[model samples]
Target chain A: MSSTQQTEVGYVVSSRDFLVYLDGLPTIKVNDMVESDTGLRGWVTSTFEDKIEVLMLDEGAIKPKQEFRRLTNRLGINVGDFLLGRAVNSLGVPIDGKGLLSRTKTNLNLELDREALGIESREFIANQFLTGITLIDTLIPLGRGQRELVLGDAHSGKTGFLIDIVVNQKNTGVICVLASIGKPAVVVRNLIDTLRLNKALDYNVIIATSSSEPPPLIFLTPKTAFTIAEYFQKKGKDVLLILDDLGSHAKIYREISLLSNKSPGRESYPGDMFYQHAHLLERAGNFLPEYGGGSITALPVIELSLSDFTTLIPTNLMSMTDGHLLFKAGLRSQGQTPAIDLSLSVSRVGRQTQDQMTNLLSTRVRQVLSAAADLETISRFSLELPPETQLILKRRELIMEILKQDPLTAIPKQIQAILLALPFTTFLQNKNRSFVEKYKVIISEAFLKHPQLIPITKSITKLKTDEELIKLLEAAGAVLAKLCP
Target chain B: MNEILSIILKDTYSLTSLKHRLRILQSYFLKTFFGEIETSVNMPLSPQDSNWLKSLPSSFYQKFNKDNIYNIFSGLEKIGTNTPILTMHLAFELNDTTLSQIGAFTRKTFDSPSLLLDIKVDPNLIAGTALSWKGVYRDYSLRAKLEQKRQELLEEFRKFLR
Candidate 1:
């Protein structure tokens, strides 16, 4: 196909253009040109007062019209899909042969150079974004508006985890922008295919900077993505910006540093590597009351070693973010889908959403897990222990049971609270034997029935009319009293 | 540490190709600056590159004669003059100087014939003026660019796969 010369005729700041480039085309009356290219020789779909938009006909169309018609839907430049395992170039072009992404108003005002909102104007992230995965939704919950760093070694599911978050957010009606930088051609192809299978390409916008591109373009990928997200956010939308991996960004900065003839720091990196990363991660926080209609949640992945976190980049980011979810290669080796090492993972803002379920689960599960973790440490030293120690062991075992979950399992909030409210902690307080023999089954059954008892659970937490609460109690009084009592 | 230094020394042996040699030499200086001195792994320079290194500044030969310089140029086989490479090195004088001052000194003052020396101030090197030219090599830059690239690569590679 022959190439067309595309040029910016004028810079439109808002509605006004400063200067214009007409390419010396013949001029005709605006109304007269509406009929053809001599006037404006393109198909017209619609017209407005200020301007008329038209699709340019291929070079060989016969008898150009004197008047132009605005054909909004008839434009040949359709948007395509780029899903998981797909590769795209810097200009939002599909390099992975996935076809163009499904179009959705491609001509949006996508602007860059956004001024970062001040910290005082930022809101604290408290809401839990439910990922139908039981382990994530119930246990190590991820909070909305939090800057979460997903780190792993090579091929350790860093990109996969980001995709899962985007796919799950579909239910929340959240817009997702997957920004890929310095990614390989083959991997991009795979990502697009995955998105197509999930039919998620329609809801997502992908911006990629391939390894073969210049440093400036690679650096612009994330910024351009944030600009797109800003568009969605301005419309009161929740947007997730996923920087597949930031290592490449750091590399770009290093190249720039070398070219600038700056002194290299440890590992031949620029002295300001940490600052560059911090600047991007800091942009992920939620804007406050003044800015309505949007929040951006960024998941920037960093690859690390089996147990090493002291490396410069990981350590710097660890302190910058609210916290990180460590996806262990060893766990993946054991066939874990998320490969999240719950023992070391945490969400600092997770406890902020204090409805019945979150409160019950976070407090009770944490108590059991913490106690069990300590007891396990002691158990290794001595075979024999106090009676309380045996009880602690039982409690620890129960905590592990709660932690046990299928990777993709999505647990409803009602079930999440019930599992937390179950007297697993009390069971640990009792004699280890009886608790193991009887209490375990009793608590498990209660937890399992939690969803069925949701009417009561909602009533218990609802700060509303008394009649609904009374009706809920009447329906599930026996179970409620039995557990809480 | 020794292995790394040796690798760097070996790489820098092709001194005639200024940039490559500069890159390798900078690697050595950075490690030394960071207290990570590695043993020199000098590769034998080809006769052509060796003759080019030999034709550098008289002071370069005087300070680091054949024996001392051999440790630095063992790996480089040859660097034909036809190539474009930025040969960057630093030279320490008794007085403080800037790049312009050194360049002025070499162009107007220093009596040299075969080696064309370009002097520049690089405070990253401790109390020295940098000598950057094809035939001659010196070091005294405040910092090294190669070290920065290596560090960036290590950091990025660690995160890229994750």
Candidate 2:
């Protein structure tokens, strides 16, 4: 092709607020590729009654009447197994400077047909997705293909919680996609480094669009990551996608919409803002067996201001998701590592996914904690309380101490069942605080030595009655007492 | 405003033809103020004008009264200054019939039909056409095809040498 054919020139008429208005190009469509004579690239954002507006892809000086040409190519990226252990931007360009990805590519705007998957194809979510965190695995049991929102105030261990989940999924054969939108470059770099150090990057794909990038690219990061997750899910692999925060994604979208001259509805967000998020999240679910019986369990994080849960984006996500794990700053101040508020956090569908033993253990633990919380509030006013209530409070404190887990140390599901069941047994009641703490360590060490016990605990799913479950728990307790004593 | 200009520019060839059509339209607007513009310029109530009149929506005719017609012309001039007319850059010139055929094709492909074809000769193209419209270029020339298949042709020559 001749040089003239390589470049077809259209004059820019005006420029302002990072948007350039071009005089020519009557055939230009919205989202069409555009480039300036000076090597600046952009996309046609809107076509007014006269001039067309182009959103610049790169920051540079674009002058009036400077010629630009349409590139005629839509934005897309390659997707495949090669993407695992790699870091990419919204366009799937390798931002990690690793190398080129595989040649098998797909469009970024590839539409997932939620209707085609349909309600008829969906199977009941019976299998539990283990996060390996004892507190979460025991209390808020996550079902496969469930979308659970993680809401927390700043510095309340939200990202730490997600990182722990990713770390726990290491050998579980779950492909993890962590999409970070509008985070600072340093934070993103640290996260990638953490994943690398933990060796979790092998089974993970990190999609990072930083805070400094254009709002449009930042807004597209999670959807691009979801598309990548869906690619793996189509192959029948279980995928755990953690969107670090949708609050920033929504803000970036609002910024883009306002810049494009759209009328803002509530809190300066576009009217379709909720639909935009809902549609993206609606792509996640358990598909029918004919469609590969795969699952994508989404843990979309939402940052709160001063522990406020009534914000527009948070409430919208809460309604869309199965349930939320509300992280509390107050709990963090009180030295809770995960900082999760037990009363506020819930898993609506996780109960169906739990086996008999886990359900029984979780119900007993919740009862002790709830009764302790009420008695403690009353004890704040009255120094003297019922002796039984005092014992429940002491037991609740020990349970809380047991749940205070460090980051990157995810307990296996079987070990978690054994450890949680130890507190509910009669042997621990009326025990001194120091003795109970020692007993906790001995129980952990006992399970660590006898890995064979995990299989026995797992096989207890065959137990037909509560009597059988009680007998098994008592037998396990007796074994632990013999080893620890 | 663009719609009116597009209809005027559709079959118009030269600057003289464009001016003539505008004048006829101006007179028609004035006559419609008194009663109705006689249907045609060359002959009153001609079949072409009657057909054109019948082809338009009733709402369009009702809205484009004498006063609004002036606004349409002013709006067209304003649009001409603010928005550049669609231009097609062609590799070579063709006969009027062929040019009209290409013009009609462009009208159907693009949103606007009031396009100006800027013709230039490039003998290097060898036989096929090359055109650029609305900042997008398409090269369908014979030279382009040969360049695309250069590797395959070179392989054939290597086989012959062996």
Candidate 3:
């Protein structure tokens, strides 16, 4: 219970009177504003038979909780105020060394304990959440109020992709809740450090159940995280909930089953595992419609062996998601970050939920990439192909030259559109030398008008001395400009 | 001869064959009492008198000069008491008159009861025949029980075989 009880030291955030009791010590008055001899005032919030929960709003807060575990001296207990951009444990003690967390007890309750207030958007998906990462923004674009499962083998960049998405959320103004269940303490430490270093922790709320904690407590970690997200959503803020990996959470269910005397199924997993995974993921959908307008976007990660999609965990999530972005292990070995095999990865909601502009850009780029793939496949079949086959191969080589991009870097939408619509189709089709000479000016003029097409234009500009590639770019640019316009 | 017997059993199948065999064997034994054996319309012994003959072993009764066909065979046939059902696994062996009596009893009970009979030969039973009915396996073999008793005592049956 919380009350507006002000003390001489600082403000108290409770409604009911609490007796501060440090076990085996004399009890202090519930309303007393006690202070340490060290000049740090302690504002007590609640007291239990074993421990006292106090908030020290002063500059010099109490020592870390772990250090005081053995001490019997209870000289006015105090913990510093909780602040954003710092890693704190469940008891709201700072774990990351980024100093005490700044806290203001809100009139509203922090833990939203209510069962889902019946999602206002029964089954509606719109208003995409943009993660400024290029490969995702361009290809499998994420939508608000949808659950996407990123499934892959271990060491395939699942956590890396999640971190990238969380970091990129700064641009979209979305609040993030990263819930790590059954993860190592070191992982939580590194994540907190990374978030703080990037200043992304200012918008992030972390809830962790480390491997050393009891299994039952670890099981409730993700649910506690969603409750926090729901609190943000009620205040009309968009929230992103990322379950670092749910496979271990399912292992907790299997442990519960074994403890409860149930027979294990394949791979020692419980028989009712489908329901466990399905219910958890189904909770991640949009709760409030655009009319009332608040959103929760979920990205649940599934780990498999050697990127095998047939594993029970991966298969169950694959069927539940709006789409999946697979990170291939082979690509990761090749020093590729976000090692997505683009040809195999796809978004089901590609054109379905996108604006007309993004769809037009993505479709043209996809077609050019597909064409390049086909030509590359055929050139291997015939060793001694004709001159026309050679010409097709050359055009394909030019397409790859234009499409190659670094995944971590993002290209803006307007630029993405211009690159797809380069007027090189006509020049690549040019046969007569007179037509090549005449249309070369037409292609250059088109590229000069759209700065977005500068990358490909610069490449073709370099190939001006090489007549063949110049002709290819002019032909390709003509075809794309007409199609895109 | 085996083929002829199979064909005859296949065609003229009836309970009368057992009765006919009983009469023929009874006539041979009747020569011990009468000077010559005679095929008679009626049996010399009553049903009550045949009951004692039924208890006698086939080895002891078969050596008698008096007619002993149907008496000994029908005697051992009275061993099994339960009715046969549609699906069952039963085995038969003619060790002494007990085996013949069992065969006759099973034939009468299971003829119209949809039962299957399997015959096996094992001389090592050493005494009374063994019967396995339905799922229950019974061992009336003296040799088997002797082997078990010896095994329980942790002794080999090597001396008992000679």
Candidate 4:
């Protein structure tokens, strides 16, 4: 459609916030681009028997009987290597003021029917996508193609967790796509700055629709991000797509639906809300080798209201995703950096992808933590406890301290394995608690610097016996003790 | 000058005579309950459109004597605004025949003879006519045909080259 053509003129019948009901054009599709004579840009959202509702892309004055023309093409974005390290809106227009992206354009709503691909086309997710966070890498290990929901309250380190994962993917060769829907512009800027500071921006693509943007664009951001990720996925490259939070996305959809006169189902959310999110998340999976053997790991964040997991959006996401990393507000207050509640958080398919050594070590850590939690509860009621229980509580304290990692500092999987295995060894046993605490950094540093340990750590995944793991841990402990002493 | 007539041009076959009847009814309504017609017509309906019946003013009940006012607004809502729709399909420029055909189609499509046809051109259609009447869009263009048989055409071209 030529932009110069004055082909179809529609007059606005009624004007609402971000939505205008126009009369005359009856053939607009759900996502057809529409532009007004007064320079207002929008897209057709809903079509009724007689009227069409348009969601404005900008906050321009739309009076009654305003003329609008339907653009011939559907919404699209430029997707290629040019998008890497750049910030763009849902429309793929560069918002970072870095100038226009001159690349081959592709339709934003390219549908990938996973159901038609059949079972044989998809590979078994056997490889681990390490986040470098000890808590996540060990306790809730993520498979390359898994969709994990990160649930937490506001300011509970949810974004920080995702940023850390993206930062860790820097050298790992995973193309990271962060879709910030309805986030403040400043927050998006800060996130981009953080990525640049860590030099991870080279491997990152930031697709953002800020809070001030129209609801339609905000709703389109995540889908656009997924399309970009899919573009790279088809090239046999792994992509990590992080939707910062789906809560705001859901709210934006609800707003658009209400403005379009759609009936609200639960909590005033549109009825198709569940299907809306499920369809987007369903696009992510590990494809077969014939399909380039690529994977798009989606880590969709959901902010909980008062740490309530039973809410409408959270429940819908929980059911759709593989499992969730529940970041507790209480844990955050207690200074647990990631604030992940191990008992509540789980990875349904991650254990299968982990090495036997990691599996063994994580299992032990879980047991110790669970025991400590139980003891803490029991000791709260009683003044005294058994010596073994006391020691378990002490070990838990040290383990918690070890898990307190600085944001964006992603520990290598091998390093995480070594650090986790230390609690089970004689390195901290019988030593003064303070002395062990003080020397913990020295021990980790020593383990990280060992040249022989790198190859041994790589081979640890192949080791079959616990006896071999125990011997290796003992040898590593002896070396660490000598270095830290 | 009636707001209803101005927005309902394309669906004039049924609404043309009804538009005259509504103008009379609207004038009478204004005389009895000044500006109430605008308020009643512009009142927000429930998102589901289920509560629209009950949300009507009680004064409308006494004045209209029957539920004719409700029926009129509901009908008005269905036909939408009277803006004439003209959808044009072109390979490039709007030829004389295509322009005249579109003009004739618009006049015949709507009850209001004064309503102008809205024209939109799609160069992708290659050569054909695509019409948007009332709220429906129909494409009778060669471009659409090419798109439908794109794969077959590609194969045929490849065979011809061989």
By summed lDDT, the worst window of 10 consecutive residues in model 1 chain A runs over A1-10
User: For candidate 3, lDDT tens digit of each residue in A1-485?
Assistant: 01111111211222121111232112443423355435544334345554455433233434321111111222221122133354544334455666755544442334312244455554466666676554566667777877787877788777877887788777666888888888999999888888877778888888787887655455555666666666666556688988877888888767755664469997788787886666656656555445335667888887777667887777777887778888887877765567777787767653466666556556655665676677777778879877666655554444333333443344454343334343234434434333333443344455566565455555542332323343444545555456333
DockQ of each candidate's interface versus the true one? 0.01, 0.24, 0.00, 0.13
Task: Give the per-residue lDDT digits (tens) of candidate 4, residues B1-162.
Answer: 244434333223222334543454454454445556566565444442323233445654464534466566556545543434444444666554555565556576664464544455556667876655543445567765666678899999999999
2 or 3: which has the higher lDDT?
A: 2
Chain A TM-score across all models, in listed order: 0.68, 0.88, 0.65, 0.91
- Per-residue alpha-carbon lDDT of candidate 2 for residues B27-48, written as tens digits (9 for 90 to 100): 6666767554454333455565
Candidate 4 backbone overlaps, count:
8
Q: What share of the true interface contacts does candidate 1 keep?
A: 0.00
Model 1 spans > 4 angstroms off: A1-88, A95-106, A138-140, A334-337, A381-387, A423-485, B1-162
Q: What is the TM-score of chain B alone in each candidate?
A: 0.19, 0.50, 0.29, 0.40
Residue A100, candidate 4: C-alpha displacement in angstroms = 1.5
Indicate the docking level reached by candidate 4. Answer: incorrect
> Per-residue CA lDDT of candidate 2, range A121-199, in tens?
6878888999988888889999999999999999898999899999888888999999999899889899889999999
Lowest-sum lDDT 10-residue window in model 3 chain A: A1-10
Q: Model 1 chain B: which ten-residue window has the lowest total lDDT?
A: B112-121
Q: List model 3 lDDT by residue over B27-140, tens digit each.
A: 535544564434332456665334534544576543444354445445523321122322111233334355345545666675632222334455666765444443223455
Off by over 4 Å in 3: A1-84, A88-94, A97-120, A287-292, A371-375, A384-408, A422-485, B1-162
- Interface RMSD, model 3, angstroms: 41.2
User: How high is the lDDT of residue A62 in model 4?
Assistant: 87
